[model samples]
Target: MSENIALAGADLRAAMRICMQGKFPGVQLYAHDGLTRDGKPTAVAARAACKEEADGRKLQGPERIAALTACFNGKRPDLAQRSECRKEARAKGLDGADLRKAVDACAREARG
Candidate 1:
């Protein structure tokens, strides 16, 4: 499978863990758009839209993957900056999870 697909799988796994912890009763739907500077994992624009029945209560689902498949298949931005960041992290022997956390921090900063 492609790198984006792999990353999306990883993200979905993480999201699943979150959902389980949160005890969300609805099916999870994810929609990803755009990419971070790093080509490793693209940015995700995800939402969980619960299916509702006629009584305005949630409905069980056959599950929907939605546009997440498309997002993961789309072209990513340049990896130069992302590579540099990873290289720096590696050079310092930073923890891999820490590096990911740092990347998330940067993304949040950029978003604002």
Candidate 2:
């Protein structure tokens, strides 16, 4: 694992949040030209992601997050993305079960 990749929850979130909120300064999203399958630049996907994040923040507790983490193995999210997730975990104090979940998630993705 690269030292840049935080294998833990809180640490990873801190790095990631920094990147997402533009704190890192030069990072850019290489998304699909902000377009959808319908050839529309509506940014619906971006809006939905933001909405989902807001909604997820409402669900308190690590167990709740753990359940969500258990289902989605995004197949080894890149170091940058993992950093963002770690940043989010830090803000939310997701250091317990969430940390375990993050480790398990990394392992699962690596295995695949």
Candidate 3:
């Protein structure tokens, strides 16, 4: 039973290696079965860029996490900034092509 379990583990690792290679293409597999080429357990590194703002205020706790998740899912947090640009243009009585040009300028300035 121990030998069968060991074989199954090896099979799983081999399958993982093949799948990783096919998907990643150029990424080198640094470890197999948790040990590195130097026979050390792979160290996992994690980072959180959870600083998100809404209406010029920083989000906290669950709100921050939710915003981070939204960012991870490809949602742009700068959408509010764009909306603000549109509002500013309208307040200045801009319309038609003039409003579009002003909004574009505001968007560019916001990005900078």
What does candidate 2's lDDT look like per residue over 1-112, in tens digits? Answer: 6565445786876666566758645654333355544443434444455446646767557754654443232322333355566666567677888866775575456457
Residue by residue across 37-80, what tens digits does model 1's lDDT show? Answer: 33234333211211112114422232232333222334222333
Candidate 1: clashing pairs of residues: none
Give the total clashing residue pairs for model 1: 0
- The number of clashing residue pairs in each candidate reads 0, 10, 0
Candidate 1 residue 108 Cα shift, in angstroms, is 4.0
Tens-digit lDDT string for candidate 3 (47-88): 132232332357777876776556533433355567789999
Ranking by TM-score, best first?
3, 1, 2
Cα error, candidate 1, residue 102 (Å)? 2.3
Best by lDDT: 3
Q: Once superposed on the true structure, which residue ranges of model 1 sit more than 4 Å away at CA?
A: 1-28, 31-74, 78-83, 109-112
| Model 1 CA lDDT for position 6 | 43
Model 2 CA lDDT for position 68: 42
Q: Lowest-lDDT window of 10 residues in candidate 3?
A: 43-52
